[model samples]
Target: MSTTPRARVGRPRATAGSTQLAPRDEILDAAAALFVENGFAATTTRAIAERIGIRQASLYYHFAGKDDILVELLERTVRPSVEFAKTLREDPSLASAAALHTLAVRDVETLAAAPHNIGTLYLLPEANRDRFDGFRASRRELRDAYGAFAMDAATDALRATWTLAELGAAIIHLVEIVIPLRRDGEMIDAVRIADACLRLCGLDDAAIAAATGR
Candidate 1:
């Protein structure tokens, strides 16, 4: 709804919920878009409330303030990837590093495309650092899962090569790159970038090809 900019906090997972949360999510989603388009300092909860066709006072019932809405936006956006990556990691039948890389590729593309989500997350203020930590921990579960997968693929070289760390950084950096892309008003094409980054992360040409299904 809104595409501006704002501070980013942790993104948690989206779960099965009722229609009541839907309107709240709509408000947060609009706020995130506005935050990405404008900037956190410039964004107004009133504007978000307006975008949702509601009074500013009504917005308070769904979220406490701007930061709370930002956090909700984050949860709506980022949590699914972590959850999905966990599912992939739990599969014992997974054969190659390519599998993990492949799963990451899909998630990376999704993460990269959601610039409003990314921007809002970064706009989170330091005073909100405690909630930020919780957000990070919630999302980190997926990263930890992927790291394990990456390390396993690297012949248990998690520490020796820091494969998990490297891969995790690579994945997150892909998200970070979206920050500027959105600012520049460029095409937020994630698949193209994800392809190249995955290669650099040691996903072989064949694996990348398979991941892209191209």
Candidate 2:
């Protein structure tokens, strides 16, 4: 027999399933950055693929399209808050002010942990499209949760001056603004932000400190 090439053993090749998933995760990371930097509508598959050193066709192998990427990102960013809100709603034992404070802290922490400014995705016009219905529904659920929490804090006069829905939206907007600013290295404190939000709902400093546990 002629010289037979010896079987070479090295690191085992990645499983086909795992190999497939690696590119998908990479695509999502690149897409999140581009979507955050350029807005969902402005970002292209080509750009995202280029950023990750993959072909646009390869990106599509993982995601159906850019909207699919956006949907995944939204789920990753917003689903935890939605689930937390559900838990808070179910726990009738918890005081509303305390629950609201906890929600604020958790929401801020979630935003800060994201790799990109996920708040920017809320501003995308395409976010209203039928393809993004799941995202819209999840966001609406979060808003309703906030509204319920705000109602607990609203006085009769405050309720009359601003509807519970409006107050909830304002709280969400405040966090949205602060999250991105904090990402940019601003000296933002989560407890202080929570305290400020409680203040908007008419909680005094003592009440805020008590509710937020300082």
Candidate 3:
């Protein structure tokens, strides 16, 4: 009866530290900051661990490796918007312009709220590697959703002048301006950006105000 219980064997959880994030999230936040400041290629697993004040092995308990972390981060950049886009698609009550406005606002908020503006890591050449195919696919899904929404929202004249591909790419690029805005410490107003997106598709003020609810 006096015998002590056996200690669990496997990767150990991170000990409490300065960060309020759960151990895995702490690693991601630290890595995002370092990756943005120091460049992804220059950041290492040991460095990520050191930033978290944890052993390198402890990182593996949460992520398989640096690439795993990067993949997860990249996916986080688009997954929410893509899922929301899907939800918007199934709602028939929303007009195309309103749906597009809603989607764009959601996208802006997603990028603006990302931990450490990790969307800045999106251009890393390493992100283009085969290991990141899943992220790339998810991003494409978001892009396609943008394009579909744009086509539906475009005015007759606008549609006649622009292809779906062109309109979609334009909206997504506008939403992504939030990344640089965040990097430069500029303000991010989701409604303003979303309104601009509608304008880009040829919506007038009344239509924009209607769609954007402003």
Best candidate (score: TM-score): 3
- Per-residue lDDT for 1-214 in model 2, tens only? 6998999764333222322347778778778888877877788998988886766666766778988988888877678988998898789888788888788878877877775766667767888889889987887777778778978875666777887678888887776666668657787677777777788888787887777666
- Scored by CA lDDT, what does every candidate get? 0.63, 0.76, 0.89
Question: Per-residue CA lDDT of candidate 1, range 40-120, in tens?
Answer: 668888888777677776677777888777665666556777777767767777654655566656665666556364544
Best by lDDT: 3
109-202 per-residue lDDT for model 3 (tens digits):
9999898899998888998899999998898788888888888888889989988777888888899999999999998999899889889988
After superposition, the stretches of candidate 1 with alpha carbons farther than 4 Å from their true spots are 1-22, 112-117, 123-128, 155-159, 185-194, 206-214
Question: What TM-score, over all chains together, does every model reach?
Answer: 0.69, 0.80, 0.93
TM-score, cand. 1: 0.69
Candidate 2 regions off by >4 Å?
A: 1-22, 55-57
Q: What ranking emerges by TM-score with the best candidate at the front?
A: 3, 2, 1
